[model samples]
Target chain A: MTLPIETPAVLVDLDIARRNVLAFQAYADRHGIRVRPHIKTHKLPQMAELQLDAGAIGITCQKVTEAEAMVDGGARIKDVLITYNLLGEQKLARLARLNERVTVSVVADNATVVDGLAAFFADAGKPLTVLVECNTGADRCGVGIPSEAARLARRIAEAPGLRFGGLMTYPPADGAARVQAFMSDAKRLIEAEGLEVPCITSGGTPGMMQAAEAPIASEHRPGTYIYNDRSLVARGVASWEDCALTVLATVVSVPSENRAIIDAGSKVLTSDLLGLTGYGHVLGRDDIRIDQLSEEHGRLVSDGQIGLQVGELVRIVPNHACVVTNMVDAVHVIEGGAPKGTWPVVARGRVL
Target chain B: MTLPIETPAVLVDLDIARRNVLAFQAYADRHGIRVRPHIKTHKLPQMAELQLDAGAIGITCQKVTEAEAMVDGGARIKDVLITYNLLGEQKLARLARLNERVTVSVVADNATVVDGLAAFFADAGKPLTVLVECNTGADRCGVGIPSEAARLARRIAEAPGLRFGGLMTYPPADGAARVQAFMSDAKRLIEAEGLEVPCITSGGTPGMMQAAEAPIASEHRPGTYIYNDRSLVARGVASWEDCALTVLATVVSVPSENRAIIDAGSKVLTSDLLGLTGYGHVLGRDDIRIDQLSEEHGRLVSDGQIGLQVGELVRIVPNHACVVTNMVDAVHVIEGGAPKGTWPVVARGRVL
Candidate 1:
């Protein structure tokens, strides 16, 4: 049978995505926290608009170009908080241009990033908003301690054309208490200096259910929440039905009784295992394991008869939704198993 | 200091790439084997043109869309081989379209794929070239045994508008003996049936240097040889200087004395470990390891002082080159340590 969609296509179920958006938004609402859905997962302006319409305060982006893509895609996104350190003149110039279109805020863990932003926005009529990113044990990018966070907050407040926004942390999984302690200490320190801490943002989909534990956070930026993936499902945060995006692939070759190959490989599904065993969860086939992947071929193996023929279609929930979304240019939007049109992943390839 | 290129930019050294192409071409020439460089690594029609100009027989693409991109980019590419099973109406129609522009050939390991190709090209004036993909031991794709290869060869020979081209295998590393055994047996069987084996192609970058071990192979299709990555360096196939591609990143944060974060992450470097320990090798900083990666941040950790300050630029040879090439939209071409123009990754996102 000819499938409705082509092989190696990213299928986003609009109904499921809308449900996911509302579920997370409702969760954040009960906790008295604002939802600023990160656009890194879907990268589609329509999806961001759907989140904004679902009562999200604004949006969160990881890079300056992401915010530009969101605004350029014509989404009604007015407030964008870039949760990354903006370094160098080229990116800051782009960020300055984007700020002209929307209210753009950024995060900085050090004074160098603060100074770079200050230099770029120094001559602007409206000063740029800057937040201090606290490490909080993530050890990825952020200030090591609360004192350093306060120091950067002070630097932002003292710098020209920059306003001290708040504190932000891409917290460790299940470490909401640590995030709370770090942000609270930083807030007290900043407040001791007579500067108001406007917003404390912390997020991770694995621990979003317990977001209230980090009571200091005024807002949560969750990217994969709108398109639940295998990682969240494996962490018991979401069920299989909650996954809004899946990779549709066709079985091209069955080399052995226990082995079959699909067209979606690392290039489509990506190699972001996120600690998962296989490349993805083959829907309706629990016994098969996506064992290995080349650039364009995913090896599916089973102990017995693989039970897949050539031209057969299978849907896969990738381990990480954000990386998979970045792999494709566009995705097929589906509603109740019927095909809708395609949505360009506008914010994709905006890593600059 | 301001860097010449932007942070999180992929830098391709044109000189090193040209040297790699010529070196590999020379190796294959000495073995009396044809070189059909796979464009899956760079995905640039310009790089393909360089390889073709440097004594390569043709270019090999993994998908129909990749071939279309190469031709669309106006790369003077004539002969093309798509090393994938063409299935479904959409892909077959695309393959037919791509065939109109160039000499496009494909591989099939099963009767279903062969039938699909036959159905698509049956109405065309010229027949499609079909190679029976053999399963030497990669276990990814291809027919399992010599008898199956011979059986598929006969099927292709009998099908209208289809000609049995030869046998093809994406072989395992250091398994050239098994590949030779498998192909020689299949070639003998097909020849016994009064069919001539035209071009037996086998390839893998790890085993490319040993291409002569598979005496039956008339051509070698090596993708990563053009831009050796950390994986090849780890396998002792290519040195660090031989690596033509590097991710140019800036140190965004130094959260701890022994840890630093770069602007490049999975969005730029990708998560293709290729069985390596870390995400990538930090150039000129062997003591540091790119231990972790988020979507837009790469964490560099060291046992001692990391010695990287915020705003510092560092080049990184990623674990896998092909996936890294697919991550970004364009790569800045560097020549003799100077900046040149950027080349769009033409075949990127053409996973279909």
Candidate 2:
């Protein structure tokens, strides 16, 4: 049966998505690195199950709410590592409660977070596993140097309710040497203090395949490999055919010879260029450029050679797959250009 | 009562918001022009009710779902003008049904939209009011010139299910003269065809005050005036104090002396620069700049003078408020720095 879908719906190619899962899992296995797929890309429980079924060690989440949703969605999750500092009394309580149900671990780069976390689980049956987030070269989160990461890890090992899990970092793209140097030094410093470094995690889809080059990283957590986006394509991580997700939109206006407006806008396609030019890539329309986006209108510019009439359905591979994942509540899962089922973006807007 | 809130939550200062509503209504009131606050900014029925209570003639929406949500939110909406092409079988039927309950009008820039709209409302009790969307200067949508507007208006007037309802345009910022000339010519053309030109509407918050200077405009639709953002402040249209909405985030990682990471990323604060320099204006900190943002991290760069510690809460006025509104599921309404209530962003992600 065909479903009458509205315009501007998120579409997922199930065959490609599953193939992506198997391919990445096989590559990691061949390279002798554990695969811990991040749930922030698709957020669907079924997708998480597919990754787990394909032999991912566990799942990685940036927020506690996402982990909770995956658990509620019946993923049979055995391990969850949130790569964000769990802050505030309210969030700490939620984290503790979530820990009660599963083997949950988190990362922290500061003493305050460690102290706040220690206050809650100081005498629990199973202490919370904590990792020192190292910056490496991403320059966004984590400690700047190996010494800082070692200092934070020592602080965590001394805390009563926490056990030092290991080290984690989302390194800059194509910076495998920096990841190796950062993790190896941090491990050396922590091991020098007679503390065991059980694991070292490095992640980023752009450099995920090169992660095995860094002997320090026992596991890698890459999110966007499941549904490669335009930015990934620009970075040579994935080709257009490897992109599993696309926004299905209908052309609503042909105002001029060179301009057409689609129903998809910043609300669905999003404005995250991620250093790429234009908003997205149109399949089979290399001549068209989605140059501008209004709140509800995507302004398409062409060279007047392509006659895209009004009401024509066009599929767009967005610049960033993660942002588009959070834009829609549910997506149409298709296999071989046929409808299969719809999956809810289970953890959308779980920023808290 | 003080409610414990989470970080990266969308907060609306009720006092500032109501004051903004009154300020814009007063401007349109003084100029003897109708006010129609666009509901796309806040997407809350309570906000629409406030705009209507503050003397707005009606509310403008970009989609039928927004209108339906406002009506369901108990805004007591009597009239809704959807400033988009109403397309598709399902959507047009819903638009016709919406017109049955209230005075529903829409804008069409081409014959396809007009023909589709006419097919749905050809035998209704009241014909759907159709406005010719003209391109004054913001050439995203609408007819190319006054002649094109006149042509579409004539087609709508001849159609049995549609009524020619004057002209509308999202005019170029600070181009009130362009609006006057374009709209006057279109009105003259429609008048020569022996049809009444009841209204000519111009929209945009950047130069909404100057919209009254356009002699042809009988109404103005402004959405962002209710919650001014950093872009408006940069445009010299509103002050930082005038911004009502802010993303409340906590410092998650203080990686280095000059860099800090916040919990609000593109998921909450968004990546819409709107030709502005930074992501947002950090409240009470002129020295810090939000240089970059990831999906779950906002990279704040400073000059080592500002000391932002971990777990420190910060309020940020985002670059664009409307896009941020579509990011969250709900917002906290605050009165005198205390939480009064929580209102869901009811029309968020309603791209259809």
lDDT of each: 0.90, 0.89
Q: What's the TM-score of every candidate structure?
A: 0.98, 0.98
CA lDDT, candidate 2, residue A221: 94
**Model 1, stretches more than 4 Å misplaced?**
B1-3
Instruction: Give the per-residue lDDT of model 2 (tens digit) for A247-342.
Output: 988899988888899999998988999899899998889899999998899989987654788888899999999999899889999987899888
How do the residues B103-218 of candidate 2 rate in per-residue lDDT, one tens digit apiece? 88899999999999888888877899999998888888889888888889999999998999989999878879999999899899889988898889999999987877896899
Model 1, residue pairs in steric clash: none
Q: Which whole-number lDDT from 0 to 100 does residue B196 have in model 2? A: 90
- Top candidate, metric lDDT: 1
Task: Write the residue-wise lDDT of candidate 1 on A231-328 in tens digits.
Answer: 99999889999999999999998888899999999988888888889899998999999989988999999988999998888999999999999999
DockQ of 2: 0.85
Interface RMSD, all models, one decimal each?
Answer: 0.8, 0.8
